[model samples]
Target: MHRSVLPLVRQTLGKHPAMMGVASAATGFMRQMSIKPFTPANRRREFQLKDRVESLHACRTQIFKEKGVGELPTIVVGGFVPDATEQVEFQRPLFREYGSVYYLNYPRHGFSLEMFFAQLADLIEYLNARRQRPVLFGVSFGCGLIAQFLKESANDPNLKIRGVALASPVLCTADLIRPEGEKAGGVRMLESNLKRILKSAAEGSEGVERQIERARRCFQALFETGAANRALTGRHLSIRKKIMHVIETTPADGGYQRVLALQQLDGPRDGEAVFTGPTLALLAEAEDNLLVPTSPTLSLLRDPERRRHLFPRLSFWKVTSPEPDDAVAHASLIFHHHCYNPLIRSWYHKLQAPQLFAVI
Candidate 1:
């Protein structure tokens, strides 16, 4: 139910900037109520960092070492999952081949974008203390987080980021929600479909639990309907179940607050100047199930003229498969280890080469 309201609010804001103050205040109150206060106990239990200022949870995957090497390079992953234990474990084989991997988890189900950025900074500092700069790998929302971090920490001497790899990066929220012309109609259609899911669940239960149930149903319908290519339905079904589990368990208010934060994000426009490092952006050829129309970020990256100006150092790849399922193509870009792992390896090697960074 609340999911429907969020987009309406964003659409309203686009038309009338006068409501910005009221909207911001409302958003602030929601964020304050939903996000849990950070504490030392949480730090000890979740992060296992003995000397801790705040709490941050992460799943660490160590690389296999030969006898004499000092230590393998580290890869810090930023993902959308609040509890990423299983997801991180699933990527163990792929990440282990490159270096050590750490999949970070948020302290609570709901947190503001600022809080997320700060937590990522803390993780980077912790890693930098033990090692030097670590490669950053971000998927979906994680990509936006990494880009913001790069912007904020641009001039910091101690925080050197080695490289970045983004999979299905969400560069512009507006591009996804408020597309122009016919695409805008498609978004409305998708929203209408989502509302139908909520309407069907209205009779089952009442209160917060019911709302969560409806939200879960709403997402399930979106995932199912957005899946154009039936070939990937089996894999999508499995992923969708996990996603639904997260949505079901998360507090309703927190989930809504997170959505509000995403709505407010301006994406790469503000952060482009600072992101001058080796970057690999993997984009799916088909429309994302989550974002029905292709995002402006993807369009910008695809255009040679815009790409040259915005992401000069970025290596872009438009990934596609012969399979009929567009959703499968999108999912495979991230989950299909055999296809993407080698690409990551090659990029990592190129980033490490002194000559690559020496001149032009």
Candidate 2:
């Protein structure tokens, strides 16, 4: 093993500790892994659609089970990092509590948009028939999707979305500009590389294996950039190590945008009216340091007017310790530690807790 590269993986995963463990567990590409896909009584289905404006040619949806007479609360997981292939790990524990779990892969990587949208509609309808409200959990692109759904459902009272949890939620496009914002060098590099890979793949300039090679490099580049950036900036070693590990194990061929659509992926539109649900906003300590926590962004849900106008029920927490060994104060719904480790139980429970209603 490239011991020198371990630092990169540690830093990246350490910064986003909750995701570190699962990401570390992603030892190889999804195709090579023997783990079976989640199956509902209905099994899973895939769909494809074309987006003329975005030039998004495809999308997909995977279901674990079919609808039944038994009513179980559904938990939806959507957020795919190319390095994090085993997304199931994040929800398997939650599924133990919730009746069922459903996972969606965006158009850029696993499934296409048309498939994802169609399957989501079907799942929502199925849940309605059973009188069960599914807990929507989304990270990054999925966060935006959840927000859009909430906004659209504002008029539909029957929409059975009971709760929403946005982990490391991408709230603002500006946030991407830096490791703290959309302009972050790592993100820009990954985006540019993806566009190039997509162009080549679409041209059929190479065989399936070659296309996969391009994808693997893209994922590696993203992870490496993140790790390198942290190292240069003198950030924590855990984040850097995690990033390195991700780059090391991530497959050269597995596509991510196919899993998490990048074009459709936009941070919160600037100046858009704030929207809310039973929302838990997670902020990483390193990220907070990179981007100053101002009133506008920090007050995402604290202001009464904003809370009532957007999400009447909103809570916020800042993750201060990305290392479990660090003697520091921990907050509710905020996790700070190594991702591959089990430091997120409290944070996870806090997000899922029913006690948040009291704050709302």
Candidate 3:
């Protein structure tokens, strides 16, 4: 009973209104239960702010200072999860030559999309105030946030972005939840199923808790032996352990909420029309089973009409491995240093020479 199957089951049971209501109620209760009270450890490791900045949703900002000569460009990394500090730190060296890297954990790993956007806006303003136009590097779900930010700030004259690099971007949430079929119908089915589940499970608090526990177990099992874990090869055991820790510590309720938020996204089409800066989208060569498949991403970035219309200065790269054993997947893309480091460096060099864009 992998967590991936939950959506499928909800889809299949879409016709049952009673069951959908029950499931929905149970899911909401579980998410509420997942919220943990603030602790000192969270402040120390998770939400370590670099400077005294006004809090957005009580989230403390963390910036990794770079050791280099002269004022280097700043690189702001939007992490996938609140505990994404490790992921951000791992890529610090890659951007060390370019600029300082920074990341902030969400307040208690629970925030609405609007709040998240506000947090990003604050960070962008903080950098801009220092006369720094940062190169945004968004990993996983962070990619969606970055895309939305780009769209929202398109008209802001003060916000000058150097470039944007997305690694395994989760552009659309519906693609991840709904099965391969009619997109509209799939969304309706999911909604119906959720309502039915919530209604049927609208029992006393204890009963709902029991049902939530059952769902949690199913999700845990899915992560243990699911497509998402398939990317964790022996070479990436360390990363795998960190991922498992995140799964174990973070509540599935919050994760699913994030997924729901992503499902509502339409990507940065309108913003892309106005965004003339350099953009880089990195996709895994192999099929991504964890989140949405890479095909849609490739289609979005590779389609000539869409590319020309959306990302005029887009550089799309499909990361591949010569050896089957060394193949990279969605989760492993961030850890694939040998591959991404050079690619990022090349892109940074290109950004440095704006005249090259005119020549091409």
Q: After superposition, how far is residue 300 of candidate 2 from its true place, in Å?
A: 4.8
TM-score of each: 0.64, 0.54, 0.64
Candidate 1 — worst ten consecutive residues by lDDT sum? 59-68
What's the C-alpha lDDT at position 60 in model 3?
36
> How close to the true structure is residue 345 of candidate 2, measured as C-alpha lDDT?
42
Residue pairs whose backbone atoms clash in candidate 1: 229-325
Q: Any idea what lDDT model 1 has? A: 0.52
Return whichever of 1 and 3 wins on lDDT.
Answer: 3
* Residue-level lDDT tens digits of model 2 in 1-360: 498987776667668755664563453333234333553333133223333223433334444542222234544554445222233343344444545555553333244444555466557756776666676766554565666555544666545666666555554433333322334224443344444555564556354345556555655554444334233222323334443454445343335444234445444433454354555555554444222244234355435555445555665555555555542221112122334113334434554466446447
How well does candidate 3 match the true structure in TM-score terms?
Answer: 0.64
Worst 10 residues of 2 by lDDT: 327-336
Cα deviation in Å at residue 355, candidate 2?
11
* Residue range 279-318, candidate 3, lDDT tens digits: 8877776534444333355456657667656667778787
Count of residue pairs whose backbone atoms collide, per candidate: 1, 65, 26
Question: lDDT (CA) for every model shown?
Answer: 0.52, 0.46, 0.54
> Lowest lDDT 10-mer window, candidate 3?
38-47
Better of 2 and 3 by lDDT: 3
